[model samples]
Target: MEIVLLEDVKALGKKGQIVKVNDGYARNFILPKKLGVEATSKNLNDLKLQKANAAKVAAEQLAAAKELAEQIEKVSVTLKMKAGEGGKAFGSISSKEIAAAAADQLKLDIDKKKLVLPEPIKTFGNHEVPVKLHKDVIAKLTVKVTEA
Candidate 1:
């Protein structure tokens, strides 16, 4: 029997996939568990429409991410930090601080978790920060740190 998967099944298929399984398995596991439904003609048509809509939304998101990446690359964010006489920061500049600075300067709301910082910055200088906007899109932002 053919069924439309509502959610992903490990080692089987992903969500919205139409797959063939044994009749007993479909009736006992997929249908009862609400993981899948019988792939009737009406259901298949609805699935196709849903898939198309999802694809359109994904494409739009990708385009927006690309535009945001371009804007981020062109702008430089300045952060002021208290530094010692030797030019070392009192503490360290973390990704969270960078994210807040970016938000304040660029007027873009971004999560600190999305900021990819391999390590916290200790010295004051210009550094390139990578922002992961999407799985396929990465934006490089220039951060200039100066003594407060």
Candidate 2:
């Protein structure tokens, strides 16, 4: 008997997969546990429709991410910090501060966790920060640090 998996079954198959199992196993385990349903013509058609819908949604998300990346690349956030003796910075700029600055200055909603900062910025100049907007989209944001 052919079965359409509603959820993953270890050692058998993953969700949305069609697998053949013995009649007794299908009736006793797969059906009773609600892990899968008998794969009829109607069920197969439904699966096809579901796959098409998922593909459409994923494409839309990718397009939106691309658009956001473009917007992010054009933005520059300016932050102020106190200057210490011997040309050293009194305080360092963190990812949280950068994100807040962007939100306040440019009205951009960037996640601090997504900002790739190897360490707190301590220099007083222009810096390019890489922001991971999506799985495939990485945008560079210009940040200008000035002495207060």
Candidate 3:
């Protein structure tokens, strides 16, 4: 039996996909769980429309992310930390701190996980940080760490 998947099903298919499965499985499991529907002519047409709509939404989101990346790349964020006379910080700064600083300074809400810090910063200086805006979009941010 042919069915249209409403959501991703392990070992079967992804959302909006038309797949052929055993009639018993389709009737007993997929339909009952609201994961899929019978692939009738009407349902097939609806699936096509749904896929198109999803693609359009995804494209718009990608464009927005790209624009955000460009804006982020153009700005430099400064962080004030307590440091010693030799320019060594009293405490290390992590990605979470940087993310919070970016949000507080730039008014942009960025996730800490998206801040790519290979190692904690322990000195006062200027550094370049990489922020992942999207899977295909990344921005290099300039951060200036000053002694407070």
Candidate 4:
């Protein structure tokens, strides 16, 4: 029997996949458990429409991310931190702080999780930070850390 999987089966195939299984297995386990449905013409058409819609939405998101990346690249964020002797910073700046600064200074609402800092900002100077806006989009932001 040919079946369209509604959900993943560990040994067989993932959701949205078409797989051929024995008649007894499809009737007893797959159909009864609602893990898959018979590969009817209507069901196949519905899957095709769903996949097209998903692809369209994904493309829109990628375009939006690219636009945001352009804006982000032009803006610079300034962060103030407490410093001790010899111009050393007391504590390092975090992604949350950077996101807050970007929001407050540039009016950009960036998520802290998207800011990728290899190491915390411990020095009082200018630095470039990479912000991942999307899977394929990365924006480089200039951050200036000054003594408060």
Candidate 5:
């Protein structure tokens, strides 16, 4: 029997995949558990439609990510911190603070998790930070740290 997987089945196939299985297995296990449905003509048409819709949505998301990356590249976030003796920063700046500063300075609501801070900002100077807006899009942002 040919079945279209509604959800992933370990060792069998992934979701939206068409696999051939034994009649007993399809009727007893797959159908009854709702893990898959028999691949009828109507079911195959539905799968085709679903795949087309998914592609469209994915393309839209990629375009939006690219646009955000461009805007992020043009932005420069300034962060103020207190410096102690010998011009040493009291506390290092983190991704959370960068996100907050971006929101305040540029009016961009960026998620902290998307900001890549390989090391904490510990000195007062200009630094370039990488922002991951999407899987394929990365933007360099200028961050200026100054004494408060």
Candidate 6:
């Protein structure tokens, strides 16, 4: 029997996929659990429409991410840190601090988790930070750390 999966099944296939299984298994486990439905004409048409809608939504999100990436690339955030002897900072600047500083100075709602920092900022100088706006888009943000 051919079935259209509503959700992913590790043993079978992914969601919105059509797979063939034993008739008894389809009637007993899959149908009773509502994990899949019989692949009729109506169900197949509904799946096509759903896939189209999902593609449209994904494209929209990608476009928005690209636009935000352009805006983020043009802006820079300045941070102040307490300096110790011989041009050294007292503490390191974290992604949380960068997010807060961007919010306060540039009015940008940047997620701290998206900021890819190999290491915390510990020096008092100009640094380039990569902001992962989307899976395909990455923006470089200039961070100028000055001694306070």
TM-score of each: 0.91, 0.88, 0.90, 0.93, 0.94, 0.97
lDDT of 5 by residue, 8-42 (tens): 99999999999999999999999999999999999
List ranges where model 4 is wrong by over 4 Å: none
> 125, model 5: CA deviation in Å?
1.4
Candidate 2, 72: how far from true, in Å? 0.7
lDDT of 3 by residue, 99-121 (tens): 88989999988899998899988
Q: Which stretches of candidate 1 lie over 4 Å from their true place?
A: none
Candidate order (TM-score): 6, 5, 4, 1, 3, 2
Highest TM-score: give the candidate number.
6
After best superposition, candidate 3 residue 67: deviation in angstroms? 0.8
Q: Clashing residue pairs in candidate 6, if any?
A: none
Looking at model 5, residue 93 earns an lDDT score of 95
Per-residue lDDT of candidate 1, residues 1-148 (tens digit): 9999999998879999999999999999999999999999999999999999999999999999999999999999999889887776887899999989888889987788888999998878899989999999999989999999
Per-residue lDDT tens digits of candidate 2, residues 56-106?
A: 998998898899889988879999989989877898999999999999999
Query: For candidate 3, what is the TM-score?
Result: 0.90
lDDT string, candidate 4, 1-79, tens digits: 9999999999999989999999999999999999999999999999898889999999999999999999999989999
What's the ranking of the predictions by lDDT, best on top? 6, 4, 2, 5, 1, 3
lDDT of prediction 5: 0.93
Candidate 3, position 123, lDDT? 81
Tens-place lDDT per residue, model 6, 1-148, is 9999999988899999999999999999999999999999999999999999999999998999999989888989999999898877999999999999999999999999999998999998899999998898888989999999
Shift of residue 134 alpha carbon in model 2, Å: 1.4
Location of the lowest summed lDDT over 10 successive residues in candidate 6: 83-92
**Model 6 spans > 4 angstroms off:** none
